[model samples]
Target: MAEKEKQEDYRVEIGGDDSKRSYTPAPAPSVSNSPTMAILSYCGASILMTLTNKYVLSGYDFNLNFMLLAIQNIICVVAIQGAKSMGSISYRDFKMDEARKWFPISLLLISMIYTGSKAIQYLSVPVYTIFKNLTIILIAYGEVLWFGGSVSRLTLFSFGLMVLSSVVAAWADINAAISSYGHDASETATALSTLNAGYIWMLVNCLSSAAYVLGMRKRIKLTNFKDFDTMFYNNLLSIPVILLCSLFLEDWSSANIDRNFPSAQRNNLIIAIIFSGLSSVFISYTSAWCVRVASSTTYSMVGALNKLPIALSGLIFFDAPVTFPSVSAIAIGFVSGLVYAMAKVKQQKVATTSLPVSSASSASMRDGLKN
Candidate 1:
């Protein structure tokens, strides 16, 4: 315990003091209180998961979004259970009461993932990356309304830049699509129609993502769930919801299976699916941990910073065009992220400096009560 305190003391100097924050989303368990570690882990997992999911959903004939989600959830549960049996991880066993409380977030998770997949299907990764910045805006205001947290003016300015980046990205995506296709005027409007669908889905994804983050933060307080427990409940509850969607909503006919899982691509799809499922366990856990140790808005900002590598990966693997407008937008978005981080650092310093005055007032109140 002395050693742990010394480690935490050293981290306080390096990572800023979490206890000094005006409002904490929830009390973080000691094991997962290192905000820096949580943020870095989450960013890595998030980037990998996004690229892998994109690869899986990239198949032109793939239309089994619900089925794919169900498989991922199943794999998460299996992986966690296997790890538990091996004594590699520690988390509480299944409890009906906890599951009941966590079920709503599971529904939100379904919407977030389903809409995300639908959007990425119709959009390029670069366009998708820029549009996701909109979620940070939503989550920032959400933290204000729900957690009594305040957004600094600098942060708000950064938000404006993020919005500009998205608009520029959308404009560039459209122009590039039309010009690069080299289609004659006689061609139909297929590309435009697809892009329009993607935009609609992106809006829904942003909304669902904000709600999921806020909802999970609130639920964490009520459930007293650690990151591992939250992840366990999320994947476990999602399995049934996704399975239900796959059963009634999705076509399960033999013909559809062959179309979605073509013989030539079957083995590759399986491999990707397995890898995605395994990685999801870490992604979900680290996400919950980041939200626990830091605010949802900060978690969102880390996501913003994470897009640089993501955009590069998208270009390398997915053939997303590297155009001037796209590069400019990525640069603007990256700058916005840096500005927001600076804003947060300033905000924390102010909070920490005021703590002594609050402590003094509390001491006086205690003395008065004793009298």
Candidate 2:
């Protein structure tokens, strides 16, 4: 405990106080605050979100991603407030200053969701999931830039594998795009167009996601905000931004109200929407909870490990083609992600080990000077 305090003091001195932030590491996981439950909730919510979006966008032709996200944000705000009212969780009262500090991160969050939904609308879930690995690469680079850390040789090697795997997956997508070559010229043209647009949106989503995660890290550290506080601020503040974007960007005239959202189909749509919103809530809460209980590296590893299952589920549920190239690309992506996760875990362990030694050395020097 003394050593831990010394290390904490050393870290604060080196890292500088984050605006006189009242820093508090979240409590360790117990039966009441279970890591396993958090992980399960995160995984389930993520999978449901992916599957639900695919069904709505691809199956029902409901292409208003911005509008959908706005609705989801609204739902999040209402549900969180309801929970607070019931005393399920506690958060500090919202202040204008804190909202202003949180707005930039909210913008990044909006971009990430908007672009990701657009990509999912165009790309099959499997292809989209594989390509989404690119976000890991971007986040790794962001950490290096923001935190002033050096990447290890092994970590660099893992990054190389990830890059190679992403390239191969992209190649497979291109090949799939043109595979309808002889069947229907018009269909081939459509597939090619969607593939092109999907790749662009996917890349945009990766960049935005990386930025959001990094910004969220800064906000949490600097403001000393807890998970529920972060969720409340992000969703509540994003509602208006999302609404404005929807008004300009979405084609309200093109929305087939009767066909896409008929009264008879309202049940399915309602279920999908409600579940989608709730799942998003689950994701946000669980992700933050998991990171608090476990380490950030563990949170990252859970995400990396889930990719393969998600990819496989997509294949099983969707009508996508299964060829040697596609299979190989998926395998490569899964393997590369695993390697990246391992490299990251090792890197974090090294950092942890070095912290105690550095703190001890500093303590020794202080003692010697006093003597």
Question: Highest TM-score among the candidates is held by which one?
Answer: 2
Each prediction's Cα lDDT score?
A: 0.77, 0.74
Error of 1 at 181 (Å): 3.7
> What's the residue-level lDDT of 96 in candidate 1?
94
lDDT of 1 by residue, 90-204 (tens): 8899999888888998898899989999998888887898888788778778777766667778889989998999999888888877886646542326777788999999999
What is the Å distance of residue 102 in model 2 from its true position? Answer: 1.1
Candidate 2 residue lDDT tens string, 94-123: 999999988998888888889989998888
TM-score of each: 0.81, 0.83
Q: How many residue pairs clash in each candidate?
A: 0, 0
Residue 23 displacement in candidate 1 (angstroms):
40
Worst 10 residues of 2 by lDDT: 362-371
**The candidate that achieves the highest lDDT relative to the unseen native structure:** 1
